[model samples]
Target: MLKEKGLLGNIGVQVVIAMCVGTLVGAMMGHSASMFAPLGSIFIHLIKMLVIPLVAVAIISGAAGLGSSHSAGKVGFATLGFFGFTSAVAVALALFMGEVFQPGMGVDLTGVEGLFSNVYADKGDLPSFWATVLGMIPTNVFQSLNEANILQILVFCLFFGIALSKLEKDRRDPLINGVNAIVDAMVWMINVVMKIAPLGVFGLMADAVGTFGFSALMVVFKLFLVYVGAILIYGFVFYPLMIKVFSKTSPVKFLSVMKKPQAVALSTASSMATLPVTMEACEEELGVKNSTASFVLPLGATINMSGNAIYYGLVAIFFAQMFNIDLGMSAYLAIIVTSTLGAVGQAGVPGPSFLVVAVLLSAGIPIEGLPLLFALDRIFDMIRTALNITGDAACAVIINDMVSKDPSHAAEEKVQNA
Candidate 1:
């Protein structure tokens, strides 16, 4: 859109500049830098206003489009399979890196021991399998919408979208068109909002840095370093490989176009808040089908949290090493399973990942040192959130390619040609 405006016109470039300046300003001003926070808050609220409705309408439109085809069920399964597989791989990689680096060993906890707390101990109990399933099925759809309950919203929209697709074309087309119109309107609004993203990003970065300086990081610097390396490996190495093998996209181009969404993800640290940018990046820049992107991206944002899986696994191992607890083969398996599942169960919003608590508890790791990490969770959350959105886009691109190449699609095109 800003092609005529040169390099600085690009949203991604602007955000990066804003972020760097914000960081310097924050470091200089310290806590007082929070004065710019309203810019960030206003921008986040604007994005939040659009997210629930956009997700609902977009998914319904996507599902209906796919449901009209023979590949709906295939698309659904493939997306879920991709999320599960990537998440499992992420956890395993984190575990491997943790064991190799041993970020938790030789930690002088003398002064920092006071930061440990049992406040989060009670939050570690994971819901039963059946309960988690049941919770996804909302008893009140409107209430779910009001609360912005993403999983429940996804459940209803997918079901409703598929049902809409079953109607006669004369009936379905009008509703689908109406839904598409809403999506287009939302997209336009998002574009308008994005013009101010640089200012908003500046506010967010300044506030985060000013409030939580680099001092807290010194305590667990090794753990933080390892965490970032895992994210980079996953984002730059693993996802690019997946795209190269499974889709037509070049890894370079995909990464290039992704800078905008990744910047927003870093600043917001909430996949849900960054949903609009991710969707636009996939559909416009990556050439993913709206039918594929709308369905897959939102679902990915809600549940496909391979980034969090890595964090949970690494943190579990870190604490295990710190406390001198020997993790057996069973414990490793538990960490893998728990971390993967826990990552999926987490909400996409920015917050302290108490799910890490569950992962630690599952592997018999200590949770006492968790508060130390929590203090620096913002930085950790920002890095991982960027990776999370990248995973979502990769799955969308790969799945779109799969659907296009399906035999059923080929036959259907031939039938139309005839």
Candidate 2:
């Protein structure tokens, strides 16, 4: 859509300009830059509006539509396990990278010391294991949607979707169709929102730089490098190796088919919103079985976030260091578990993936460091979303290969059968 229509037509160029302008203008505007916060907030609100519904319907349709597959249970359980394994490893890698690099070591936090003092006042306390598990099931689905509690929505969708799948074909078709329509409508809305993304980034950058000054930017930049480096290692090295080792499929062919989904994910910074395109590529481009693509990709989008896992690890460590907190071996290990689990429920938005919850749910890490982390969130969200998509595709590829003895012929038969 952003073809050669002149200066305003190119989003990449616009974002670059906005980043530069935001930093320069924010520095010049100083305290007065607070005025631009609302603009950024508007953009976030636009993106947020789509996340819950998009995820709900995407999950419902993807899971519910797996009715005709013979090994739905096997495929389903395998998919979930793959996600858990990959996410655990991703967080571990992040912890290692963060500990080695020390992204926030000696960074000044005094500038934003007071910014997050009250951000989590009511719910800042970390809940116990029982409370955390209970909270996952929303008391009311309507209320969960209103609050944008992703974990709750994911729980509801999983149950509701499986129920839909068990119904007679005629009984389930209408509900699935309705949900699919809503998902499509949401994707359309995302396209509209993305047209104005550069403006949103500008306002967010302005508020961030204006509030914390450039030193925080440097800290965030270092954190950004750590994240990007981890994503590269995971996406390029880890993911392809898994595909090659576990699957008979060519990584080159897999990535070639995945090119569109990866691009869409990076630009939108939302795996949930990019579901349709990703699924299409999986079935049509990659020749993955419908059973594998339907079950694996949807679950992966919500819970199997390699990128979020990495970010969670780094952010936890960075926050701990910023507050002069020393982490014991137990604290470090807890972060690995916390981040892996926390990532399971993290909404695929551009910034701050359940930051409040990660801080509240996990051990260690002061709340005061949130402002610095939030500043560069959008900066990191893109690459991580791409990594997130890569993981999803990898999961599908491996699962498809595992279930099929003859990958090519079986994929074709599954497609025809589906």
Candidate 3:
């Protein structure tokens, strides 16, 4: 039965089953909770181990591929514009959703103290916003690579890609091709690893259920609903309208091109992991120019996290409300600024955004309320990942329309053929 459904299909089914089974079993066998927690931690670490290298290689190779194409500069600017616009819209939507629903009103957090103590202990103090921004520029390339600093890696990739593009064709071709081949192999390896995602997800789900129990879900139900609802609005309404207004392409066609990448994003819950697939889909399936996809998607994945930004802001406010912290206009303004910067500066890895969310919360509200969010973090992480990738693709489409030498030509030809 599982085999008939295919790998990802089975993985999804397994995750649902695991969550249900874990909840029931944990409730029954409370004594065995310790065992399930360690297993889940191990699985999460394994996923974490793959993240830095995968992001570094994928972004570099994607940028290098863009360099091979001739229109790097125009494509780069259009991509920047797309990211800026979409990110702004995402923040707006998050604020709107957070305020309209007020996901944290009347939530009880008295018993949640011990729930996230370990998580809090692991988190260090947050650097100032300017410091975080300044830190993105690597002092030493090797050191940055060793540290797996995503922003530094991205800066290096951009310059290296541009330099490669500026080189003589013969000199650049061999290097670019070699890098591309390695990237392809790495992507294949990732796919193979992801086939075991069900196991990993099962472990993670078991741990969550064991620790929090299903009853704890009711505490944050409103926040969960708001987050999911906001993402859906961004995906269906905001993105399509942007495409129609700015791109001159049918929203339906754009969504079709985006489906596969979006699915990959939801499963992996890492935009960096989904970059290779996203770039490919954008270029081949969506007819986005290679130069555009190669440059835009990778860069966007790193810095253009519209979804994450919104999430951080909403969570900050949610936490404040839960703690009975009255956030005035200044605090809300601080949230908007800090969350936007934090999302861009934070590394695109699992669990890292939570760190940034922690930082934002500390700066804007009381840190004691952080634990409440940790209980529901994984569920929201998956939703945020989906939204992040969807934003990336939507930006790519908008940018593609902007930079196409003749957008009307392609649309007219397609219309005539249809």
Candidate 4:
């Protein structure tokens, strides 16, 4: 609806306009627009820099912080279940839409010579399934970081963070503080890089449209519908049912309290950056106890990426369509599973699509197809980020009710204790 409604004035639309202008200018300039490619690489590099370290410290910080707490295992499990459930539904929904819509079917790839990097450049000895399992736990963390082995980094952080979490507070505080500082530093850098997004998006768009022309953009525009539609359905239909089925909270009431943080998330496109408001909404506005809010909201931001799950799912399948790669039933299953699990590892950055789309690498899509996706990202990012934050708040409400010994008595106790 970004194309139709257009009232929200989201940054995505502004970037979309910039892309359009870039296309027109590039069409006029013709071959000279080739210069924009390297300029566009600046944005891609920024995204890479943001995602790698961001995912690393986010996992570590989340693990160490949760480890420092004494949250009930029941609450933790329930929150995890909520995120996984919503994420599965979201991806499935997107996969269905992509199949039905075939949004990328008519997109032209002609003249896109060398636009995509050879995805198989890093293809190693295809591991036996067991070796693949072992591979995720790296022998050297620094080596994993250097290689940008996201899967390995995720596994290592899990263990390190869990170990750090179990240490006594006297020993744990320093590590936790250090992790926070690293994450903050990365955030600052990302903020600086984002200032160039408009120019970067323009260059990327100019190159893409000049190569493929306006006719192909119809396909991406339609694909954006798939992304945004899945988000809307999940937010309005899936979550409303979740609220009703899981607890007695009025869906309207729950959604109403979330408006402030949801707005913040929509504007910023960084759930981690919007954490303070989300936490406040969960605790003060929605009446979740601080004990539950403290653990669930933070963990949800780090790991609960239902929105990213859907975007990447649709994208993986879309690109597979573009390149004429048929992912069989098993690969379809892989997309769902990988995307869901990948969401857990997705960095809570301003533009997280780059990280999430790596899930498609498992399906054998070329990494070169990514710039096209990146050019169209901001429009989709706004919607997905809102879904991510809403999923977090909704889980807090649902799990707050779930973890209480007596749902009816819990509210009374909360008020009395407060």
Question: lDDT tens string, model 1, 68-113?
Answer: 7898889999999999999999999999999999999998776666
Per-residue lDDT of model 2, residues 1-418, tens digit only: 2222252235556667777888788889987887988887887787777877877877777677665556566677888888888889988898888889988787765555555654654554446689889999998999999888877888898789889978887988888888878876776776677777677778877887787777667766777887889988998889889988998778888767666666556555778766766777777767787656766777787777878888878777777766677888888778777777777767666665654445433665666556666667666787788889888988887877776764554675668789
Q: Candidate 3 — what's its lDDT?
A: 0.68
lDDT of 4 by residue, 1-418 (tens): 0122223234455556766788887677765776787766777666666666776776677556545443455666778788888888888898898998887787876654445655534532234558767877899889999987766876687568778878887898898888878866775665565556567767766775665554445547878877888888888888877888987688998877766666556545666656656766777767886656656766777779999999978898788888888778877887888888777766565553555445677777656666666545654775788899999988988877776655544665666589
Sort all candidates by lDDT, best to worst: 1, 2, 4, 3
Best by lDDT: 1
Q: Per-residue lDDT for 1-418 in model 3, tens only?
A: 0122265445555555655676666666654664676655655565566666666655566666556444456667777666666666666677778778889888865665565444454463567768876887788989987777888888887777767766787998787787677667666766765665555555555666666765576677788888888888888888888888888678998887676666556556677777776777777767886656666777777887777877877777677667677767777666666666666766666663555545355445655555666556766776787777777887887777765555554564467479
Per-residue lDDT value at 177 in model 2: 86
Q: Which stretches of candidate 4 lie over 4 Å from their true place?
A: 1-71, 110-114, 119-219, 352-358, 406-418
As a TM-score, model 1 comes out at: 0.90
Candidate number that wins on TM-score, 2 or 4: 2
Q: Which runs in model 3 stand beyond 4 Å of their true positions? A: 1-28, 31-50, 65-71, 116-130, 355-364, 406-418
What stretches of model 1 exceed 4 Å from their correct place?
A: 1-40, 110-114, 196-213, 415-418
For model 4, what is the alpha-carbon lDDT of residue 135?
73
The estimated TM-scores of all candidates read 0.90, 0.82, 0.85, 0.66
RMSD (CA, angstroms), candidate 3: 4.7
